[model samples]
Target chain A: MKLIKIFSFLLVLILFSNCHREDFLQHNRESVKSITGTWKIINAVRNGTDLTDRFDFSRFKITFSDSSYIVDNSVPFIVTQNGTYHLDDPQYPFKIYFETPDNFTKELDFKYPTTNGVRNIVLTFSPGCSSNSYTYTFQKIN
Target chain B: MRKSLNYIKRKISWQLTIVCAITALVIAACSITIDSIDQSDSINGGETMQSTLHVTISTNAEEDNSRLMVAVLVPKVWNARNNASISFTSSITDGTQKMTAVPVGTAAPQGNGLDWPTLINNKIGHGGNLLPGWEWAAFYSDNAYNVGGNINLSVTVNIKIKTSQDNISFKLGYVVAESVDGLSNSQYYNSAFPGCFRVFGTGDLIDFCNPQLSTVDPLNSLDNDIVTLNFDGGIIDNALANQSNIFLCAKGITTDGDTLNLCRQDSTTQLISQGIKKWSIDIWPRGFFNLPADKQLASIQYYFTDATGNVKVGSTGDGSTPFTYTFKCQ
Candidate 1:
């Protein structure tokens, strides 16, 4: 009887610990790898407009690390912006979202809406933004 | 007994295998059923309209007791009493004359007709609405104050300012004085600059040739702001004052003069091929880098400064002219 009791107790403990282990591991599957290096903008499509010739992003750079990111559009009139970002996968084709210092959040589910990948990628201005949404498509220019 | 032991061992092994299989199934199922976290709504429409950025740029380098004595007279001449106040102590030396130095924090004798002009009198906006490179201060020393006098003069002035929600502003200001003393008998006053630029490369320090000064000052309507002395492709002859140790300097007619200097250099191959220059120093009374480049020349930088001394202001990290630069080679 004592041996039976010990086995039963051990079985219960194992079951309890394993209950949520799988779920937690699954939730963190997309974030185990480092996504803070550089990303190249393959192509962008925005709002039925082809605005690719508007800027040059060949020498651009997108740097993300330590909860901050800098998108330096390496061109004249450098359209550089820096803030915090979030993602579902934190990897290639990562679902990216933008946040500002004042806590304004904007999502870039994919790329742009106007110009296809031919134009430089631009992060568009979102709904309720008083300023015109400018789209910026960029490949990581490391 | 042996038969019973075998039965028990078989049961335990079966139980363990069953548990492991269940665990794998649960893990695979959990991974498939995972929900993506919503990170998009965290920062939407969050910024409130920001109040204007308020700031007053002043130098702490010249705030000794002797300097305060001289500063007291600045308000008298500039008539800035209503906009600000000036005070000094009898213990401080009057840098201009042999008068007994006043104590710290004592108010100076107001000059006849001394009073701060109304903000309207200033063409520049108030509450921090001034342009980025403008500085204004009303100074009153007996006008006889000269350098190297027993009375050393330093300055500190405060002005109200404001900023926009994004912490960016259309205006800025600083406290500075005008003296006719940059190089003997040369009066330094603020003049309008079209803009200013910053240039610095690795070439500044470890040069293959002799040392030379490069500038990035942009003066409005004056070709003098865009000055350059090239030492490349030829032997710099010292007989011609042609040594690469070229020195450049500019003095403003007022406090509006701006200064820029090259701070660093980086070189690389085709992977990262463009040059990246960082702004290293700003000597304007009101510090700013609003000047745009008039021309882009390969192997060179275009910018301006009031005088050559301004370029070297922060060379030793003294922070007097506080700025730095970076250069990228690829």
Candidate 2:
């Protein structure tokens, strides 16, 4: 009887020691939103008319890197020259500021909307005449 | 595949027949037919432009407290809302009936919650005007009458629009419908596009009626924007119309009254042929003129030329005049 009790206790101890460990659930924190990297024109409009097919905006690109920016094929953009750009608010951006090398800053209203599960940065500006307003939607390429 | 295609065609025929029969029924219920429209080809600015609309309405359904509706498509610059008046004489009415501007925001019956002007605009469209800046002006009879069932009535609408002194050419359109049916059904309304009208006032001709040899897209542009200068040689005979190779000769006027001329007949200024005598060049004013970073352009005056710089074309389709495009934000 003594031997049997000793064997039972050893089996229980071995079973408990060999059992797998339970993992505690961990929460995944949200990532910081960004507008960096190269963006190309995904869609464009003029005076409420879709100009995507009417005009060739395929080569237009605006690359954003930290504070400074550059333009590839210039369309009627906010700033014509190579300039610095920043969001009004990083967390809840409503506007963007583009400052030229000469310190000429042009404030532009922008909307960041996700289209078809992809983020798009929309900018509206009147390059030629005030009556002709153009909205350009950009999507990140790299 | 052939058997399947034949079966599809048979099914489509039956469906089309049914759709046509239903359309006929709807049209027979309440329909307006515009018989004619009489508008002047041209009128002097600051004067009143008169027009007339002849229509017939046949209805098998009774509508109570319904008013006659008339709408006009005109240039926004005309400000036709406050400058126009209308009166109608119908076969059923004893005397001439007065019409007042449909108060802004007055909802049209059966228009799915849209106002009379909005509904008319959405339904009628711009009457084939190519450029922007046009609107529809809608008016309603001052008094509503109980239109009897199974009755056919004829109406003659007289319209007068006081003009603004802007030398412009535009297409004129007229529509006739009743307040009861609105523009809900194509059969419920009728329209007449009487063709282009002209207001000879002052300033450069805003020709919307005919085609031009040299035209600019976006009608407005800035140095930073890519402006397309279109040369349509097919429409009219010009010096460079028969030439296959056309080049651009342009002069950019700076903000400070400096001119940058690029009149070379090289590949840099050559226009891309879109086949069929249509040539176009998309140019960035800043780059094309080699404009410095500090300098800005106020406008550009340009003309089309052929190889060897001998043949040239300008605003005057015959190459006598140069076309000027102003860079403006307004």
Candidate 3:
């Protein structure tokens, strides 16, 4: 009887530990859902200078649905493109990989969940040797 | 009773050991199958794989007939699989009628060098038609494949000209004149002002709608005579604008088969406004007229140099058979 009681206690402990591990994995997957929706660019800055007035930030919008995204920018003659995007991690300091139709690929670093529904995306483009960084602030609309 | 208990315990222990061994065997088999599937996916272009194809067509000026050299390049990722081949088909349309270009011959795949025929044909060995000039129908068999990252597969075709027809071309953007002041005026190059104008020797002026034919006599030096080249950023890639240098160079060929550099304008900077980067260059004819009358302006070449030092030369003139344009002086 004593041996059976000890085995029963260990079985319960093992099952509980397994459930805890599964919960952690489930949370990681659910985090990606926060980024799915319509986002509009509210502020844009490059380096230490504000570029919102220089660029038409109001016309720029990005819509994310599942693993695909569409970027619409009217400032540069009503340009529209759809591409595939992926997030390396579902947590903070997310790394994003974007592939466009013209075979242009870019990797951007993102800081998200700033205030619960806002995301701060930072894109660094270095053509040749000079590095130019652009930081865009996006607010979730839908 | 003690003997029976011992027998039962021994039997249960043997059963447990067998069950553990079977479970381990099942897991090992599952792992090997999963690994095999992943390897197969990588060899084939799986859902996660991405690739691009680039095609370029150029005229073979050395050949007497109108021959077009077509080059097809595939990304390195596409060639990772064994026995990978690409089949290509193209058609050229000249207004009302369309004709297919036929392959003259297949030159071997050129590796890294841009040189034609000799080097490429010796390396890969080509299989196609050997006729010169453009063909009514062209086809490249599935023998072309990317050897490596830098190397590309190229094939040459002859374009057959049935009738004198103008090939459809698209003008992504155009150069426009800015107002007399520094401020930009959309109306300066519109129908009202007509962006192009000519100055005659009699001190008379005429505005022409066609900018290419805008002429000026060498003697007219009274007017300011300014022409602006407007570049629409919307039509071009913004990334290219940020890293490219736009300039105009006047090239002339001597009878000795030498190229003469007559004059080159300074690099132009683009103005960013309303999401478009408008690049304009002002040309003062006074400086252009200083060239000796014997030296004719063969062509006005618009050159674009990218960040990687790759230069693309284009001209604003008629497309002739030999691909040579003469800047006629009035």
Give the best candidate by TM-score: 2
Model 3: per-residue Cα lDDT over B164-185, one tens digit each: 1111111111111111111122
Docking category of candidate 2: acceptable
1 or 3: which has the higher lDDT?
3
- In model 3, how large is the Cα lDDT of residue B161? 15
Tell me, per candidate, how large a share of the native contacts it keeps.
0.00, 0.60, 0.00
Worst 10 residues of 1 chain B by lDDT: B30-39
* Candidate that would win on DockQ: 2
lDDT of 2 by residue, A29-93 (tens): 33445888999998887767676764557777888998889888545666667888888877678
Q: Give candidate 2 regions above 4 Å deviation.
A: A1-32, A47-73, A81-109, A114-118, B1-28, B34-56, B64-71, B76-147, B151-166, B178-186, B220-225, B266-268, B292-299, B316-320, B326-330
For candidate 1, the docking band is incorrect
lDDT by residue (B240-292, candidate 1, tens digit) is: 12222222222222223344333322211001111221122212111112234
Compute DockQ for each candidate against the true complex: 0.01, 0.32, 0.01
